[model samples]
Target: MKDRIALIGLGQMGLPIATRLATAFDVVAFDISAERRELASRHAGIEATDDLIKLDSEAVIVVSLPNPAISRSVLQQLAPHLHEGATVIETSTVLPDDVREWQRMLEPSGVRVIDAAVLSGVAQMEQGKATLLVGGEDAVLADVQPVLEAIGGAGVERFGALGAGMAAKVVNNGVAHAVMVVLVEAFAMARAEGVALTDIAKMLDREDGGLQRPLNHRIMQRMAAGDFDGGMPLEAARKDSTLALAMAQRSGTPLFATQAAQTVYDIASGTGLGRKDYSAIAQLWEGWTDRGLAYGA
Candidate 1:
């Protein structure tokens, strides 16, 4: 069997994954950025291209795009060219409905669509510690499990039928944002009570599990320093939040916390901080209460 795969989108997340996958299989990297394409091409065993038409012969195509619309667009462009029995692994954090749409459009062409919602930062993906929440036909997944496993060090699991992966990813991102907001608010309360962030960190570390203190510690440390330079950008974070809210409305589920968080995110984006790390969300709490949530005074 030919061990070739095409990877679309060479942004922050896609670039590292494509480069890593190149170590185990022939990788064709695609991105709109000439610079990113050039960079990935330098990696051994990886070919970079700006055109999906160049990937027409590959049996497997993995898309790690930014949003639902782009994922659908790329798949649509590639659908006409994908070989029969080809599997398109969508690793974007998009809506489940979007995944279904891809399936409907491509399955008739003899192409199989699967959702592989990747979790963890780009740095983690480079280290092969990322997790993929996968949803698709069982036989299709089994055929592509090896390639998927190569990218997921945190492991991959079949969550449900098509769209389940996206559903899990949306809920996961929404809950994460909601929790971050509440944590930031609680830390603000700690500030009001005259507790230093340094002291709070020590207090938080006292717990072993279930608190997510280690993760919380890193985010709080960055916020204290007003550092939102690099990480999951506020823009990408907002897409997940808004999508979650949309899903809630469609399902008639009350998502009070998520809705509240979205308002805060809206204000953050309005302030021209959308390109900054989602940790910039601290700006909201900082405005409500005067205090640096960082380690020092």
Candidate 2:
């Protein structure tokens, strides 16, 4: 059974995902940014549009927006027009409570809402190697397998019902951000202590699960070489980190590490490094300790 899919949001994360889906299915995709829409059309073969309602009629609708508010707006706009039995897959990071609310809003209209947050980064999408944490009804999930298969690259599986997928993504991003902060802090401290920054980075790269394996390592290498580009912008990272902290607080969960990670990103943002790759969090090192990473570029 061919599944017609519509994807909304064409930002950094969504564009690649939409592109992968378009490779296997006809995707009606839209982005709030006109430039992004045009970019997706050029690169992905998506039928890009500015109209949110136009996407509502597809067999399965996928969303990969920045945060909860934008995702909710898309859901609210599309909810009234979605056909019965249509599946709505949310790949955005959002609060679990909001996911339940969306489920409630769409269920009455006979629309099934599923949370399917993409795990890992955009580079994984090219290899179709990204993992999807899914939450929704079994039968509904079964119905959209082909659509999920085409886009998920690696695969998809249910964690449980309603907001479980989002919970997984929430925790995953929180921990990952924390780890990145730790990596930056340790490297910076080494530099301040008179060890060469590049040498320390080289040492870390040689350790098991080397930094170079992750995309950020490439960015870190660049940063160490004074390149400071490649990974997600520190501004975007700050937004995600902030969202994670907000979600944790709203749920009465303590995320001390997550909170600390937010502060580090905050420092990066404050230091005018928001547009730089998140690896620029190392600037905190250079700023506080006066040690600079020499970049060959």
**What's the lDDT for all of these models?**
0.82, 0.78
lDDT of 1 at 68: 85
lDDT of 1: 0.82
Please write out the lDDT profile of model 2 over residues 1-297, one tens digit for every residue.
Answer: 345578888888898888888788877898889999888888645789998888766878888888888888878888889888888888888877878888898988998888888886889976789889888788978888787787787878678988998898888889688787766655544544567988877777773334544444643465667666666788997897777666556555555555676889887788789998787777677768887865532
TM-score of each: 0.69, 0.64
Which pairs clash in the backbone of model 2?
Answer: 128-153, 128-154, 225-295, 226-295
What does the lDDT come to for candidate 2?
0.78
Kindly report the root-mean-square deviation of model 2 from the true structure over all alpha carbons.
15.8
Model 1 stretches astray by more than 4 angstroms: 198-297
What number of backbone clashes does candidate 2 have, counting pairs of residues 3 or more apart or in separate chains?
A: 4
lDDT of 1 by residue, 164-190 (tens): 998998988997887776556545545
Clashing pairs in 1: 224-294
lDDT score, candidate 2, position 143 = 86
